[model samples]
Structures are given as structure tokens and as C-alpha cells.
Target chain A: MALRNASLSVNKGEILAIIGPSGAGKTTLLRLVNLLIQPTSGLILFNDVNTSGDDKHQRSLRRQMSLVLQYPALFDTTVFNNVALGLKIRGCPETVIKEKVDNMLAVVGLSGFEKRMVKTLSGGEAQRIALARALVTEPKLLLLDEPTSNLDPKNVSIIEDIVRAANTKSQVTVVLATHNLNQAKRLAQRVAFILDGEIVEEGASKEIFEQPKDERTATYVDGRMIY
Target chain B: MIYLGGWEEIGFGLFRALQLIFSGDPEVLRITLISLRVSGTATLLGAAIGIPVGASIALRRFPARTLLISVINTLMGLPPVVVGLFLYLMLSNFGPMGFLRLLYTPEAMVLAQLVLVAPITAGVTLSAVSNVDARLKEMAVSLGADPLQEVRIILREARLGLLTAVIVGFGSAISEVGAIMMVGGNLLGYTRALTTAIVLLTNQGAFTEAIALGIILLGLAFAINILLTYLQLRTKAGLFAAETERHHPVT
Candidate 1:
């Protein structure tokens, strides 16, 4: 029971941040949104349609979204191949794949790195590649689970900028689960604070951070709540 | 004087073996070619059958998986002579499979090697695939890969182990004399292989010829294994270098 009674909705083309103390089921919420795990008691509606379908339908729904984890988990291959994998999975043409991958790499500031092997990449570069790989497919939805927690300040700023641009320019809805409160306020317009597998506070970032309706949310927002 | 003479015989045999190999002595070449054909075919078939079974058993969860893996590991250490004797019985004139009449043929030798190699290849592949990071699968699925595509990624990641399995299988198939000798009949210019020929030469008291053939057999397996090992090491060196740099970054 990683998550319990967690009801959340992600508005399309908007960034929704899930902020909470550790073990508040941020990852479970993201996994549920990604359809990686089915909820036992609740229904997920994507585009006004229930996502409880057969395997093919489930796969189809999943393909429309992408998830980036705290750990990049890039393939043991060239950067080009790693970024090109999603486009390749969609069965895009070779020219289209090459063009898309190259453009995505450039967007992530890793231009001309097509021939570089992934194992040689630094932690930041690998995460950027992971982010590039996720965003390359132009997925309708992007679920990021603590995507920048392990990153240094420089890489974190680079990643946040990239995510913001992707959300604004591509109209890709973003659901970000993060332990960083400032990051949630910086990037997300609307934030949901989950505590103990439940969303205790859900509102605009300003309201949650300044005038939280719940005492727990205020303590958590004040950074005094210890796990 | 006798010990000195023994050393001279071994030195001369080594020299003669090199000459036979370099000059392509017709008999030596024939035996070598026959051995390669039998072992090569058997290893090819073994890789085809073993890699899939090994990879499937590693990635997928089902009932009796541990038992199946145990059975495969046990099969890997089966003695070549015992396998030969069993195969000889099965392919004999009055045996159940005797209707095919594959006895005493090169095909029979191939079948024997196939049996010995398949389990070895499968077992190695199973171990290798199981060692791949479990996070990779979840990453693949998160990137929109379906089950089949996810499997493709896993197989790609485990490519090195698969290569090792084939090389090991080929080594076993080419070196084993018992199974091929019994099933191939060790006929002159037809079924005769390096090991069988070496045995025949030694029995006929042709010590120099036997020694020469033995040296060539050992040299051939060593040369092929070295080549594959060099390729493996080259790739591994790159990975190790990168991993070391990641762990111990220079100031």
C-alpha cells in the first residue's frame, strides 16, 4: 500500500508539481499517472476516457507519456542511440529519427555528441540525455519522479530550464514529483503536497506555500516537518 | 642422454607441427577442416537454441524456473565421453532412432557436439542476462517500449555474454574427442578429426605425428580463444576506464 486514497488530476499542457516529505507516495502517484501500476480502487481518466482497457490499449496509453527518474538509467550505447530509442520504438523513419535525435540533443546542449558512448557521460550529462530521451518522443504527457534531486545546482538549473521550455513550447503536460519545495514553486504553477500517501494540500503554489489550509501542510511548507 | 633425447623429440614435434600448419599439410588440413565443420555447425545451432532459452529464463518469471536453471547448470558439466556413449547407443542400428541411420556419420558427430554445447551456452547466457540491472527494464518500459522491445533492449545489453557462450561452446565442441570419435567412426579422409587422428597416430606408435597433431589442436583452440578474448577485453577496457573515472574523479 504505497499510496492510499490519492486522487489527483493533471491538466494538459500545464506543469503540476507534487511536493511532499519522503515516502509520501510521490513516486507512486507518478507511476499511477504513467499507468505503470494500476490503482486497486480508483479509476484514471485520460482525455475523459477510462484507462482500464486491455494490454494493447494500456500500451497505447503509456506510449503517449514518458517518465524520468532520479537515476537516469541510460542504455549502454551511444548518446544518439539512447536518445533515438524512443523514436525508434515508435517506428519512425531513419531520416526522421536522425533529425529528431540530433535536434533534441542540441536542445539539451549536447550537440555533436552523437558518437559519444553513454558510459563515459558524467552524472549530469547522463541525466540530460535521459531527459532528452524522454522529451524527444513529443509525448503528450511527461511524468518526472524526482528528476533533478541528485543533480548539482548547475545541472539542476539546466534541467529546470529545459523542462520549462518543453512545457511552454511543446504543450506537453508535466507532472513533477519532487522533494525540493523551491523547485516546485519555481517551475510549477499548481502544486499538490502529499503526506503519508495522501494529497493533504492542493492549490496554487503561492497559497500552499504562504497560506496553507492544513496545519500539516503549513509545517511542511515551513520546512520544520521532519520525516 | 634419454631425457635429452625426449626433449629433442618434443622440440622437433613442435617444429614439425608448425611446418604442417604453415605449409597446409593435406592430411592435417583435412582433419582440421572436418573438425571445424562439425564443431562450427554444432555451435551455431547451439547458440541459436541456447541464447533464446537462456534469455527467456532469465527475464521472465514462471513456475519451475529455478529447477530449469539447475537442470541447465547440471547439464553443462556432463562428461563428453558419457554423452558420446549415450548418443552412440541411441544412434546404433537397433536403437529407437536407428531408422534415421545417422550412425558413424559426420552428422552424428555434429549431433553429439550440439547436445554438449547447447546446455553450456544456455547456462552462460542465463547467468549473464540475470546479472543485467533490473532498473534497465523499467527504464525501457517508461520510454514506451512494449514487452518485445524491452526484451530486445535486454538482449542487446547482454550481447557480450552471448558471444562468450558461443566461443565457449565452440571450444568444447572442437576439443571433445569421445562423442565425435564414437559417432563419427574416425574414418580416414572423411570423418577423421584432429583429436581422433591424434589418438590413432599415438596408438600406431607414431609418437612424432601424434605429438604434432596434439600441438596443433591445442594451438588452434588457443588461437581462436585468444582472438575472441582480445575483442572482449578491448570493449571491457573502455567500460572499466569509464567506470573508474566515474568513481574516482580527478581533481
Candidate 2:
């Protein structure tokens, strides 16, 4: 499908990897799913519900889903507070909020970092915190935009582990956009290879990696510059 | 004799002014208190109205926003005398609001100052609110914050600049003589302030007292400037400290 016509369904507990070169409309697709930008003309259905002008519906859809931007922008607050922000917005009770925030931090491998400020965290730590912030609300759909592109190798692995663990423990449906092929193969169960805003290949990650139906997909997977 | 007075005369005037302040002369103290009252009330009233209006304009998109901003900018430079005359007419016997019978009263002076300072307060505050990081606004909305929460976040982030707006309104109100003189009737003991008193003394050819009042006015303005500067520095430091804590988490 073209950018205007493409549609993908993400099942619960599934990690859908959207792999593409630069300017393949991957980020734009994520933004459209997150309601960051409205498509020129298309329908965005969340949980089988059409989200258009109804602010309440849109918010409800977004409340159950969240997008972690490529650049993790932490609020100007301590890490504990940042992680607790989603609960705060939902008006969660103090006792429950405290317990849940503590658990989420521990889940993200940041058990003792509740009091730490977000600014001082390393790249890996910050991404984990960002993930924690998104997961604290327990979103059903988690959209990640190049979440590990900026990290070093060690940090990339750390982020991958965190992402994989989040899916396993929470069963949070995740859709990750990435340019790194290895990452997609390692973490994603299903992969969609896109070029120039069109999906060229889609199937189980291993299937797509083993047998490509399209030459463009083969070349892209083979690391020849196809753009 | 009129022309021969030099440094000695000016020095004597300054001495007498200091003596009057230290002695707490009833008229001088009373006028100072009234000036403070008028300026302080105006500043508060202006801020109360201006902050919300500015914030609304900054946050929401509506038709003719450009025209509204243009009008506010133009009003910021409105002459004091014009405001005075407008208020005078409005509060006069034949004007629409004349039933209040507020002309020449301290309240009238306050009204004039409010009108004069509101634009300054709004304009400054508008610029401050508009300068807040757009990402912050977007993030707040994405997090399900209501409109009021959005405003609170914006105001909290831009508190320093908002304070500057209040200080600017106060400075302008306290130093203006034309509007107060017109609406206040410039009475010797009833509505006189440092600015009106200086004007009255100058008109009466009491050059010594006028010069003395001028020195006091300068000192007051200087003190206000220093206080505002100190507050600005403190606020900036606080914002930076907050930002650092947010960006750089502690071990």
C-alpha cells in the first residue's frame, strides 16, 4: 500500500517491526498512529474504533496507546516523578500510584532510580526511563520511533532487552520503526519492509529474512543501497 | 540670582529632601503612601486581567488573532495624557460612566493607571507565554492534560518572564504623572504623590522642593530597578536549577 492507503493490524503481545531506509514514511506512519499528525485523508481505527473529530474518543484511544519518540524528551522533573506522571494525569490514587510506579521502575531495571533526575541518565538509562514512562500507563499499543538508533552497541542491547522484556511481562503490543536490520530480526516477530512509502515485504521475521518475494526486499535485506 | 544657583543649591535641595524623608513629614509620607497604594493596586489589577487574556491568546488559535495582537501592541504605546482625557470624559458628568462620580478621586487615579498598564502587562506576558517550548505544550496535551493543566504548566515554566511583566506595569504606573494629575485633580493634600507633588511644586515656583522631590523620585525608581533585577536573577537561577535536576538525574 502507498502511504495514503497502507494499513496494518497489530495483535496484542505482537511486536511489528517496520523496517525502511531514511524517508520511507516510517516516522510519518508512526505519527499518524499516535495522532501526532493527521493523514490528509484516511481513517485511523484503534481497537476497532474510528478516531476522527471526537476528542474524547481520540484521547481514549491515545490513553490506551503511546508513542515513544526517536528523541526521548524527559520532563523537567525527577525520574520518579516523570515515571509517575501518567498515573498523575489519570488521577490515580496516591498509594496505588506509588506502588505501580515503583514496580514499573523495577521492571525497567531502574529499581533504585526513582529519585534520580531524568537528565543525568545515560542513553540506555534514559531510553529505559522513557519506556517506563510509556509503560507505566500500561498502554495496549506501544509505538516506538527509532528508540535505539542513537545508542552505542551495549546500550542498544540494553534497550532491546528492555523492549523484549516489556512485551513478555506486560503483553504490550509494540510497533517499532527501525533502520537497523539486525535489530528487527532479533526482536520483531513480524517484519514489514517498506520502500518509498510502500510495503514491499511482510511476513514472519524469519520467513521474510529467509525467502523474499520482491527483489527490492532482497536488495534491502542484502544491504545494497536501494534508495 | 535665579541663574547663579549652582552645585550648592542643588546640594542643599538634596539635603532637604533627605531630611524630609527621614523626618517622615506627614504630607510627604502621606503622598508616598498614596502613590504606593495607587501603583500597587493598578499593578495587581492589571496583572489579574492581563495574565489570563495573554495566556488565552497564546494558547488558542482563533480568527483575527493577528489583528488582536496588533491592537494590543498599538495600545501599549498609548500616551498617558490621551488615557487621562479619555477617562476624564468617561467619568465626567455627561459621560457614560459618570454615574460613578469617580473623577478626581484616588479610585479615579487607580482606574487611569489600570487602563494605562493593562496593555503593557498583557503584551509582555503574551511574549513570555508564546516563548515557552512548543514541545512542552504538545507533550502536556499528549499526556491527557486538560486546558487548565496546560495553562498551569505554561505559567509555571514562564513565571520569571511574567514577573518581569508585573514589574514593568508597576514601574510605568508609579512613574506616570500625567494621567494621575488629570484624574486626581493634583490636590495638595488629598491625592498628591511624588510625581504630582513634584509637578505642583514646580508649577508654584518652589524650585527647591521640586528639585528635592525629583531626587526622591529618582531614588525610588532606582530602588525599584534594583529590586526587580535581584528578583530576576533569583528566578533565573531557580529555573536553571530546576532544568538541571530534570535533565541530569542524580545517582
- What TM-score number comes out for model 2? 0.83
Highest DockQ model number:
1
User: Which residue runs does candidate 2 get wrong by more than 4 Å?
Assistant: A102-128, B1-21, B202-251
- List all candidate RMSDs to the true structure: 6.1, 5.4
TM-score of the second chain for every model: 0.89, 0.88
Cα lDDT of model 1 by residue, A22-115, tens digit: 8889998888877778888879998777988776677777888889999998877788888888777777777887899889999999998888
lDDT of 1 by residue, B21-65 (tens): 889899899998998899889999999999999999999999999
Quantify how close model 2 is to the true structure by its C-alpha RMSD in Å: 5.4
Candidate 1, superposed: residue stretches over 4 Å from native: B2-9, B226-251
Clashing residue pairs found in predicted model 2 = A117-B249, A119-B247, A119-B248, A120-B248, A120-B249
My TM-score estimates for the predictions, one after another, are 0.92, 0.83
Worst 10 residues of 2 chain B by lDDT: B242-251
C-alpha lDDT of all candidate models, in order: 0.87, 0.81
